[model samples]
Target: MSNLQNGFLLDDETELKTLLFEGEQDHLTPSTSRLLLESDFFVVAGRIIGHSFLNGGPCLVGLSQGIIHVLFGGEPETATVTESDCADQDVREVIRMLQGTKDLSEEEKSVVLSLTLPWDLPGVTVNNRHWLQEKILLHAVLERTAQQVKQIRRGLKDTGVWEFFSSRPDAVPVLFPRASEAEITPQMVIDNINWPKDEDIDEDILSLDDHCLIMSFLRRFIENGTSDILKSLLTFWTGWGVVCSNLEVEVIDCSLPQSSTCFLTLKLSKNHKNYEDFHQDLMASISSAYSGFGQI
Candidate 1:
């Protein structure tokens, strides 16, 4: 659900101007400045992370303390703020105590203003800016969503091409496939005299060459312990290219981009037994679905 449905105030489309103009009109400038006055804390003890300033104001926070600090566009220099250690109570306990509402005095708020905030991050950049500030907040949300999708896919244990493809709603057609394809067998390659993966062929002979090439590629997937990689590759493949296709070829991957991968077994029918027959069918179907992926 979207943030608006849950009544959350923090949203990408939230307008800072509307927030700043909420109350009294006379002291709007000072009140707006106060609303923007966010401090960065260094430690749980409430040492100043960086002094807060108005948006578009001079003071810019750095990501780290040691980096020569400067106020906005000035030459890089050292920060003037001093760091201090508070008494050893956990900071959250202090926050709870303050929120209990035993009626805080005006003097107390002024003295302990720094204690109210959490941590002091070094600096803010366009990458970390707010939505009403810049567009980074939206991009961060998308990055987080992508990471979650990857995480969910990793948690599944299914190894079959059909089961794996069905699990993800967003994943679709894989490589091209034939209508009545038969289980692919090693004998099919050994029995078929001339196959496509071979170089020389007469125009009259229909060879299983492409099937051999695909089988070899499948063999490479397992040659280097890339079952999980094969799964992802197949996920994109079957999810988008072929609807419900299966293969029984070996994979011989040299190396993988990450830790885990997957492999599948392709079963072919009697008439569709040879590699070339399946390869031709797959190529034709895939070309119709996604035109350019196979060419490269």
Candidate 2:
């Protein structure tokens, strides 16, 4: 039995810990963590997958003080996340170069010809002895990238941190932005984010593995309120794995047809910290919620 509080009351820390981490005690499987850390691609894959599973499930988890201290113990880093852009590049231009195909913009045709469909141009003919082998090589490369992405995400969900954050959306501060201007603009800052995005988060973000930690630290004060869930997310404890340079939460309103769209902007530090400091931020944020409710 561990001394801790959950929501509006006290709960055993050991029990909650058991519920969350006990499964790992049985035995260690193939050690994939080492491999995941070795590459940027794998890290990004984990972030996307973690966000998917966490967002797909309920929004809360039981955390303990000890873990909280370890997870959030660090200075906040300032980091920004944005989407990859390929909107303007015409598909036809790419085809013209690759196989001299006349038609472009055929997402179906483009993908197929780019991968499986073979062409018989001046020197390159599908009937050529090595043509089929070339196609196979290209397909293999694409498949590996796709497969790696899937595995990275799967690993994130298995970590349990994803589950903790997903359950407590309110605690973590969420924001969404809609396209409004002729030119694309970032939608919401973290303080203003009210919803999650359709696409999964970057794999690198989840690599930090920061979640459920906030609840663990402030279990005594949270007691069973929406604020507890919020605390679990925003409390700084969850940013451990990412190298955060700064942290900020602000709210802003915009005037546009998509005005209702909300955005949540967050900047995290890049370095990892000990558990003790993480707890202070978690508790402070939860306490500030009631005392400084609208100040954020």
Candidate 3:
């Protein structure tokens, strides 16, 4: 599943372009490359996504909501297409122009006509501008990539999950989540942890001041960390981007932070005199793990 996820998200070996999709990060749509389509790449991508979900592995995630709607058999006309969905900057500018109440300037008219002419759409007029805007948007977001979308549908069918997707509209977000929906929160991390206990007396480790202080530092770090930090920490602790069911934290006698990814355990040294030292060590540890440098 990890390999599948990487295969879809990583760059192509020959061209350094993304393997299956394109556009801004997290707003991806299926690639419309003729070469990729001719090779049935989208179909295979769909199958990988379905298989990953069925096997309870990582989701493809970070697909455009509009594209996800079309992928699951929703009408393209009904799918919302904001400027963000249009990868072309000029097209996005055109979309923004269309949303205004002001009449198009001569230059703006020329810009709009240039785009629409290629698609055989009519030039904008006072009476037809609204309709033309809608058409232009649809063309930019969906029509241009129609074949790729169709192949994805076919691929999903091959995996025998097309019916499930078509029937479960709610499942769309789960399989291909929006960027905001996929963000990891500090509470999410805190909730999944299994704090250590005093083995000698069977007492709660939280009762110890050093353990409490270390845990406080961990919480503060997570709360203040960037999204990359959260993801790196998760990967360092669990050997995966997603959180584990039972993350364990143990206060130890060492000076640096350490993790056993196999056990989902983060070992924090209680020797730090202040949060600054703890934060630095923790950052180094997670950064090393994220970069495949192993524990520092």
Candidate 4:
């Protein structure tokens, strides 16, 4: 499921050409390419998303909300379409112009007509400006890719979970979470850790200086890192981008960091000289783990 999602939807390679969907990071909508429609790629994508959710795997995050709404049987006209939902800059600009109260110039009218002409939509006029605006929004968000969206619905039905999805409106967000909802926070990471408790240490003394320093560095790094960096780290630690519960951290006798994904344990070397050394080793270890290098 992860491979399918990564390869088909989220991969950088697919962004160069329209295979199934369009848009950069997140905000993906169905493509209107006839070849893609004939290939039934979107149906396969829908199956991947449904099956992934059923198996406790990664959801198809970053899908356009308007598409999702229509996928779940909501009316295209009622589905919210904003400028951000329109991938084409020209169409988005025209959408903005229609949203405002000011009348367009003759040249601007020509541009609007030229853009909408491809969709067989009527020309914009004083009487039908608002109607044209709605039509343009629908065209960009739903009408252009209507067949692709229909195929996605067909694909969802193939998984047998379509009824489940249709019945429970709440599950839509869980199965197709927005990019922001899936974001990991520093506190989330910190709270999930099962901090080591040393029974041998005296009550008067706190944690060892080296342990304290390394832990502090870990927190600081997490707090300051970008979302991608954090996700990479999570993937390194848990063998998946999603965080697991009760991750155990151990300060042990080792030359480099190591993780046991099955046990959710992370072992860090206690011999770091300073933050620089720790950061260098940590990053190297994370890179190694991510690439499946230096694993037993």
Candidates' RMSD to native: 23.2, 22.4, 4.3, 4.5
Q: Could you give me the TM-score of model 1 versus the true structure?
A: 0.19
Tell me which of candidates 3 and 4 scores higher on lDDT: 4
Q: Total clashes, candidate 3? A: 0
lDDT of 2 by residue, 1-296 (tens): 11111111214554332111111211101112333335443444345434533554222122212222112221112111011111112322332334543433457444545544433322334344244434333233222233343443354556555455445534332211111211111221122333222243343443313322322322332233243244334333222111112332221222100111122233222221434564444344434332242232
Model 3 bad stretches (over 4 Å): 1-28, 31-48, 55-62, 100-106, 154-161, 200-212, 226-228, 251-256, 293-296
Please provide TM-scores, in order, for all candidate models, with all chains considered together.
0.19, 0.22, 0.77, 0.79
Instruction: Specify the highest-TM-score model's number.
Output: 4
- Where model 4 places Cα greater than 4 Å from the true spot, the runs are 1-27, 33-35, 100-106, 199-213, 251-255, 287-296
Q: Residues 195-280, candidate 1, lDDT per residue (tens digit)?
A: 23334333233345534545454343324323333323332343321113333232222221111113323322223444555444
C-alpha root-mean-square deviation, candidate 1: 23.2
How many residue pairs clash per model?
Answer: 53, 50, 0, 0
Which tens-of-lDDT digit does each residue in 52-114 have in candidate 3?
A: 677555577667778878877789989987666777788878878887899889999998989
How much lDDT does each candidate structure score?
A: 0.26, 0.30, 0.76, 0.77
User: Per-residue lDDT for 78-148 in model 4, tens only?
Assistant: 89876677777788888888878887899989989898898899888889999998889888878888888
lDDT of candidate model 1 versus the reference? 0.26
Badly placed stretches (over 4 Å) of model 2 are 1-95, 101-123, 126-141, 159-296
Q: Cα deviation in Å at residue 55, candidate 4? A: 3.2
Q: Output the worst ten-in-a-row residue range by lDDT, candidate 4.
A: 1-10
Highest lDDT model number: 4
